[model samples]
Target: MKNYKISAIATTKIPPERIFAVLDDFGSWPTWMPSFERVKVDLPTNPVPHLNYQFRLRGSVVYADMQVIEYTALSRATSFRINVPPLTGVNRCSIRPLSQGRYRIDRIDTIDLPKVVVGVLDATQRARFSRLAQEFLTALLRTAEMRG
Candidate 1:
């Protein structure tokens, strides 16, 4: 497996709680997330470790199963495991409080792609996922701003 990380950050003049509120609502992600097509939730609305959910991302019709392997509220961070083949790793989201009532939203993806597929789509996937990350951040920022 080839491991790689891509990150994106967006700063906003809103409280971290406001942003976290939006981020915590996993069921509502497809509505605002850039590449999310839909989510099939089998657990409660509130998130917890080990909870499973399936989501379909735009540009791909397959809905991958995912699990919340870590949810640390005190630090405002959560890590998800992609429980599917061909691709695996963690997608971590976090909120950082800043001065002046501003907050920084971060989405960091640690993707482990299969070696055979890595070299074939390495450059293309990196660029595509990077763009998607930025777009996701922009959408999250806008959604939080409007809510705040």
Candidate 2:
């Protein structure tokens, strides 16, 4: 198996608290994240630590159990995948306050997977993941701003 780190960062004119609100509401992910078909959370509201979730990815047969390992209000969150073949990760997301009510959003996934699975990802798959992450951040900002 090989270890891979995938990350995406986005800067927006949205407040960190607003961005964090979206992150805390795990059930709202499917409304914006294009890669997510459905997200079933153990809790309907805040992302409680140690809570498990079932994710259904769009256009993909892969299903995984994601457990919330850490969550800090308006700051950071980390999750781990369990019982998934050829894929597992400590996925972390963070929001930082910037100048003029702007905030920086970051998502990182440190994954361990078989070499063959990594090889199959090629440039296209990698680019797609990056794009999705970017879009996810943008949509999150929009959703948060709209709520204010």
Candidate 3:
């Protein structure tokens, strides 16, 4: 497996609680996340460790399962992919509180893809993926900052 990892960190004006609210709701991700089609959680309860979800991403035909491995309110969360061959992923997000209702958000996405598939992705695709990540982050920030 060829591993591809992307990490992003940004300081946002939104508070940690607001950002965590958006992160905890799996189904809401499609509204803000780039290329994210749908997500179905096994449990309706929010952000519990060991919670599992099925998700479709980037218009892919296959659905991936993810189980929450660790969760802490307004702080950190981590999840691992399940039952997906040649494309396992371990994704994590952490938020740190800053002064004046600001926060720092950090996200790490580690994907294990087949070597052939990675090889097929040209420079343009790589750049596009990077842009997608940035766009997703921007959307998350916007969602968290919006007034109720």
Write down the RMSD of all candidates, one decimal each. Answer: 3.7, 3.6, 3.7
Compared with the true structure, what per-residue lDDT tens digits does model 1 show for residues 1-148? 7887889887777666666677766667778887565555444454433334333332234344555655555223334444344466777777777888777778888877777866787677789989988998788778887878
In model 2, the clashing pairs are: none
Supply the TM-score for candidate 2.
0.75
Better of 1 and 3 by lDDT: 3
Best candidate (score: TM-score): 2
**Residue-by-residue lDDT tens digits, candidate 3, 18-93:** 7877776676777777666554434434434333433333233455656665567655445455444436777777
Q: Name model 3 segments beyond 4 Å from true.
A: 37-60, 74-86, 98-101
Better of 1 and 2 by TM-score: 2
lDDT of 1 at 6: 89
Q: What is the C-alpha lDDT of each candidate?
A: 0.66, 0.67, 0.67
Q: Candidate 3: how many backbone clashes? A: 0
Indicate the TM-score of model 1: 0.74
Show pairs that collide, candidate 3.
Answer: none
